[model samples]
Target: MRAGVTLRSYASRYWEIYNKISGDNERVVASTFRMGLPEDSELRESLTKKPSEGMWQLMGRIEEYKRLEDDRLQSKSKAPMMNRPRQTGFPFRPRGGLTIQKPTAQMGEVNVTFEEPVHRILDWIKHEPYFRWPNKMGGDPSRRNQNLYCIYHQDKGHTIEQCQVLKDHLGQLVKVGHLKDFVLDPGDRVVG
Candidate 1:
């Protein structure tokens, strides 16, 4: 088979995989085939499948096409979007207060101290956005905390009185410069 014929056949197969993975337009596949690099003969032989040289060449071309398409999709997906809303979640506030402990790195060198405990809260929020506060009840298998105070004081269990207490406390904290003002705007509400 001619090089053009072999390339076309390989590209068609590659497009099938790409379409399955990305749900991209078929026109994009056709354009990709037209723009893809030519197959190398030595590399083609290394992937020998039998039948004819044309078949081997097609296989090599398909592999190359898959690589290119995958890269293109990845690059496109990773491009940063402007003015994206920041996600809100529980922040890592040091409960017991933070301490700085300098470590000896080299002779006469001090390592910078970071007192924050490494909690998996940020990672958890990223992976599971809908994750509610873990149940504080001991009976709940997924509960992370068993302390009754933590359970009763949680936002989930907040009664009207508790909510008022919380609101007042937060206001006081803001007034005393202990916490920054992070008032929620109406636009922050999520419509389901």
Candidate 2:
């Protein structure tokens, strides 16, 4: 017999048995119409003539649909909960400490040599690059002394190396020059 005919025969037999067991009259009617069997046709004659393999295939499709639905429900139940709050600002706080103070002016006496113009020394000190070293290097000298030393060093091409007194106050002065190196008279003024 032809393959189509054989398959149709087997399908019709399965549909008949299924209809008898399931008592689904609508399915039996639909199957009969699909197989070209008239509403009033003889079931035994239809089976003998042609059969169908669609009923079992339809049943397998229904089983797959049920399995997919079960899987979707299981995944939803196993999902993690969402509870974290949204952040609104900076992650760290500002540190607290002493604020920087502005430079203040003070007054003091400075003795400049006769050969050195006082005004020139004063200008040099006023414009000296005070920022080269940290403020902690020297103790606060009176404004006049600070001004004199600044100008004196700048004009004579002297540096921190030539001034032992200033260097001593800065804690960076060594014993490269001694007080006895220069002659001092009774009326001579010394600021140390």
Candidate 3:
């Protein structure tokens, strides 16, 4: 029985490690055996590097291939398929609709007063998508008020008027001139 002789084992980030066995044993191998040294297998038909090709040229080609593979994988994972529906945008609306009710306890009280009602400004700002939406509240559902709904959170628990987070965001926006139209002078009006 003849024993196989491995001349070398090729290893790189571009492909899997393959053994280069001598012709006297079984495979007449090159450093690029899997790429196309045998020249018989259809899958290995694409000869990416030539034996006469320069070392720098081969490295550059391998780098190009790696970049293309990375881009392909990223796009495949991130892009929504054609069969799926596109996202409906931010500040998701509730399914059954919200019931407008006054809060039992005062919340979202800010030192600044607005020329227009806070709810009206909120309606306009939310439609234009000026601010980032708040994440859902985490707590025991039994303790939360099921009757009230917060548009800011798109969940049932608190009313939009009572959302402290929303009020804080709007206050910051007003200070930054994004909501200057909504601000009312403190001397002109008193906050209840």
Candidate 4:
């Protein structure tokens, strides 16, 4: 039978330690072993370092310090107890239960899929295809924002990105109407 190797755990931060000879250099591809502590899996993943024997002893000190710090914080945050005169009264209960519920069939849900840069003019249903997408490799800045106007308010201060008023109006529509949960809250808070 082969003899077993005993490994000691250092602090959570310094979970991995590398053992090196006096004059020998660390290897390029180092195999990291588990710190043998199942609880500290998070700290084990990080702080991968050169191997050493003293790191484990240092870990014990660090864990001890952390424990002390935690204790001090808990002690400082303790709430004081207060003494007060108490009076007792008979508890009252309702004879019957009443709960209002909406009809499930009335609630309708609609999913709308639209391509980018589809601009809707005065008429809500019919929209003219007006879109300009800039090339990632710095093609042309002129085509960047040909029409930078809010569809709801028609302002230049901000695009649909910073349109809070429009978003709130859409939310109000969802709340008042029988629109489905998905339609009420779109992926992006845009009126369209």
Q: lDDT: which candidate is best?
A: 3
**Model 4, span 2-38: residue lDDT tens:** 1221121122112212211122222221123334423
User: Total clashes, candidate 2?
Assistant: 7
Q: lDDT tens string, model 3, 49-126?
A: 343244333434434443444355448668422322221112212233443332222224646666764555665575
All candidates: CA RMSD (Å): 22.2, 45.7, 25.1, 28.3
Error of 1 at 45 (Å): 19
lDDT of 1 by residue, 52-140 (tens): 23433434455564454445544776843232222211111112222222111111232211122112111212122222233232344
lDDT of each: 0.32, 0.30, 0.45, 0.29
TM-score of each model, in listed order: 0.17, 0.17, 0.41, 0.21
Better of 1 and 3 by lDDT: 3
Native-to-model Cα distance after best TM-score fit, residue 171 in candidate 4, in Å: 0.3
- Candidate 1 regions with alpha-carbon error over 4 angstroms: 1-52, 79-192
Clashes of each: 0, 7, 0, 8
- Which residue pairs in model 2 clash with each other? 8-51, 8-52, 9-51, 11-52, 12-52, 106-143, 125-151
Deviation from native of the Cα of residue 186 in model 1, angstroms = 44
lDDT of 1 at 162: 23
Poorest stretch of ten by lDDT in candidate 4: 84-93
Candidate 3 — what's its lDDT? 0.45
